[model samples]
Target: MERRRSFPDVLAGVVFILIGGAFVAGSLGYELGTPLRMGPGAFPLLVGAVVAALGLAIVVKGLVAGEVIAFGPIPWRAVGVIVLALVFFGFTVRGLGFVPASLVTALLTTVASKRVRPLMAVAVAAGLTLAATLIFVVGLQLRLPLWGPWLGF
Candidate 1:
């Protein structure tokens, strides 16, 4: 019989606990009304408490009988591409219009993976653009124009 503590599990649990605790503390600044008339702080306070409790449970599990798992190598290229895509989307969304900006961003992110073909990337990007348009513009009824002034629309 062997008892081994998982470093990764413990670290993750600690991080979660810290984040939850911070949220809980921050929420205290706002008014937390009664259950019937819940204020702005109530939701964050409750969620933070739950997260902290979960983190504590994870820490306990890690200490008792944690399974050994190896951390995989970081995907630097994918990370870079995704970040770039997000930045591009943010910077160009207003000028390029929602459809064009989202399309380019989705395409960039889709092509970040080495296995994705050009055609597949474009298809995925188009689908994503359509879905985003439906969700943000149509469904939510956002005031953003489909085609911006930069596109002569």
Candidate 2:
């Protein structure tokens, strides 16, 4: 006898498949380039293929094993915290810069976890924000606003 598939697993598989297909289709318009040099489409194509494969595997496992996926109660507080943080990031990043925005986002996310201390969360958020700023701005040399014109960073 086959095991029942979980509803969550099935739903996840379907969602992944849909997302993967969208990615694949979206990447098709991008230039893939010659074998010597990878173009814009290369990474997206690879990601899309991997996502589709994972989705297919999940779906196949669900169907063949007959596993029954279940979900517990929704964590609304956590979701709200994350959404709020992201919204703040979207609004503040241009004005405040990456480090500050990241710090805020991290703090909010940590608090959302509901297990971390406030001080520790603040410290972690600061450290993560600094590190990320260094990596993305300094190391990668990607153009990002460090601060508004007033600060002149």
Candidate 3:
């Protein structure tokens, strides 16, 4: 029996390696000071090395004993919706404030799946919004207003 290779793992590992390599190379341009007084390049250099090593390990694992996963067709609609949702959140967060912006963003993301019902999406969105508000505003004490100037608050 022929050994099977995991295509997704190999591809992901390659991507990680490329990204890590880029960071390592970019860091070389800056001054990497000693461990005691690290320069800007030091952190990136260390991080990049770790990333590249991890990527290499992933690639090796993929080639040696990889799990077989069915690569399905790309859901372009879901992808587009998610991208739009992220953009919407970034664009409206300041204007609409945290709660409303998060709610809308979460709703858009939840509805990205075609099988999700409207009521379910709304509920999920509300939950996500509340969680985000509590985590970011209440817990973290982020200075963003719950209601922005647009709401006359």
Candidate 4:
């Protein structure tokens, strides 16, 4: 018996490795400061090494897994909807404010899935919006307004 390749996993691993390599390469120009005072390259260098290691591990797993895997059909419609929702959120985040932007985007993305209920989407959107606002704005003090200038926040 012959083993077929797991194309998706293998491709993903390669992509990760490429991205990690790019990150490391870009960080090489900057000075790497000590842990007490991190330089421009320090964080990126650390993250890049970790990501590269993870990609290597993924590649190893994919190779060892016999390269034989069954893949489900890609959901193009769902993918399109999610991408559009992300674009919408990006455009509206400043104008509509974080909560509203998040809610609208969540609903827009949720509509892509046939199994999701309207009420459930609303509930999830609300919960996610609140959590995002609290975590990023209130707790982290990210300076992004819960409501933006358009809303007089």
Q: Write the per-residue lDDT of candidate 2 for residues 32-94, one digit (tens) a residue.
A: 987799889988988998998899888878776746545888889899999999999998888
**Mind sharing the TM-score for model 1?**
0.61
Total clashing pairs in model 4:
1
**TM-scores of all predicted structures:** 0.61, 0.53, 0.62, 0.52
| Least accurate 10 contiguous residues by lDDT in model 3 | 1-10
Q: Score each candidate by Cα lDDT.
A: 0.91, 0.84, 0.90, 0.84
Best by lDDT: 1
Q: Which residue runs of candidate 1 sit more than 4 Å off their true CA positions? A: 33-39, 115-147, 151-153
For candidate 3, what is the TM-score?
Answer: 0.62
Candidate 4 residue-wise lDDT at 57: 80
Encode model 1's per-residue lDDT on 1-153: one tens digit a residue: 367788788888899999999999999999999999999999999999999999999888889877687867889889999999999989998998888888889999997898999899989999989999999999999888788789987
| Per-residue C-alpha lDDT of model 3 across residues 1-153, encoded as one tens digit per residue | 456688888888899899999999999999999989999999999999999999999898889876788888999989998999999989988998988889888999997898999899999999989998899899999999898778888
On the 0 to 100 scale, the lDDT of residue 55 in model 3 is: 91
Clashes of each: 0, 12, 0, 1
Worst-scoring 10-residue span by lDDT in model 4:
1-10
